[model samples]
Target: MKQRTKARSVALQVLYECDLTQHTPGQALEQRLAEEHLEPELAEFSRQIVFGVYPIVDKLDRYIAQHAPEWPLDQISVIDRNILRIALWEFAVAGCTPVKVAINEAIELAKTFGSDSTPRFVNGVLGSLANRLDEIRQQFQREKAQEEGLSPRTT
Candidate 1:
């Protein structure tokens, strides 16, 4: 697997565990890092994904729930949910990855970690959200600016 992809996998593992158990995300991430030999950059990327998505999980879920109305947030598999969170965070919140790359990476992760129909499910939901990617990103930006006590920049 590619290093960045491996990092995302690690993040998914941590998120999955934390979602199901009382294990703290920090502790889970620390344990996973110890178990795996990730390069510093990749490790940091994993940390970024975990922390980035962890705090805003409910917000991500709201978006996921909107797009995947057939599956309640609690009904979505932990692995699939975390994979979506990772991909959404990468492209939408962090704005560090392209939409296509994030969606493709998400599909890859789903194939590896999810059930038989997971890839298609993930693709469908993300593809639906892709139509409003810019709008979502802008809303998140506004929320962040409000939280940080800064005015959102006008384009």
Candidate 2:
């Protein structure tokens, strides 16, 4: 697997564990890192994905739920939900990845980790959300600004 993809997989595993158990994301990530040796950059990327997604999971879920109304957040499989969260975070919150790249990476992750229908489900939901990615990113930016006590800059 590609290093970054591997990192995402690690992040997904940590997220999946945290979602289903009482384990803290930090502890789960630490354990995963210890088990698999990743290069420094890849490890940091994994950390970024976990830490980025964990804090705003509710927001991501709301967005996902909006797009995938048929599949409520609780009803979505753990792996699939986390995959969506990771891709959403990468493009919308972190703004470090292109929308297409994020969506494609998410589909790949779904293929590897999810059930038979997972890839299609993920692609469908993300395709619906793609039209409004900019809007979602701006909303998240404004919310972050509000939380940080800064004026939200209009783009």
Candidate 3:
């Protein structure tokens, strides 16, 4: 697997542990990475994602709730929820991974780790999110510009 893919896998496992056990991401990542032994950069990336997702989970869940209203956040499968969390982090916060890459990676991870319906469900939610990408991106850019004391981008 690619490095980021492997990192995402590690991050997902750690995130899953955090969800079930109420462990902090730092604790979960330390133990999990020791077992997994990924490369340093991959491990760091995985750690960043684990830490990134936990604090903002409430916000992420709100987005998930809005996008997938029929399936409440608590009702969603653990693997699927973590997958969405990671993808949403990349899409909205990380700002380096492309949106399509994030979505596709989530789908692949769901296929490997989730129930039979997981890939399709992930695809549906992410596809819906993708449709709003431009608007979301603009909003983020505007916020960033404001943070930097500059006007928001026009395009």
Q: Estimated TM-score per prediction?
A: 0.95, 0.96, 0.86
lDDT of 1 by residue, 1-155 (tens): 87888999999999999999999999999999999989999999999999999999998988999999989988999899999999988999998899999999999999999999999999999998888898999999999999999999998
- For candidate 3, the clash count comes to 0
Tell how far residue 67 is off in model 2, in angstroms. Answer: 0.3
RMSD of 1: 1.2
lDDT of 2 at 67: 97
Estimate the lDDT of model 1.
0.93
In model 3, how large is the Cα lDDT of residue 120? 93
Of the two candidates 1 and 3, the one with more favorable TM-score, higher being better, is 1
Order of candidates by TM-score, top first? 2, 1, 3
lDDT of each: 0.93, 0.93, 0.86
Give the root-mean-square deviation of each candidate in angstroms.
Answer: 1.2, 1.1, 2.7
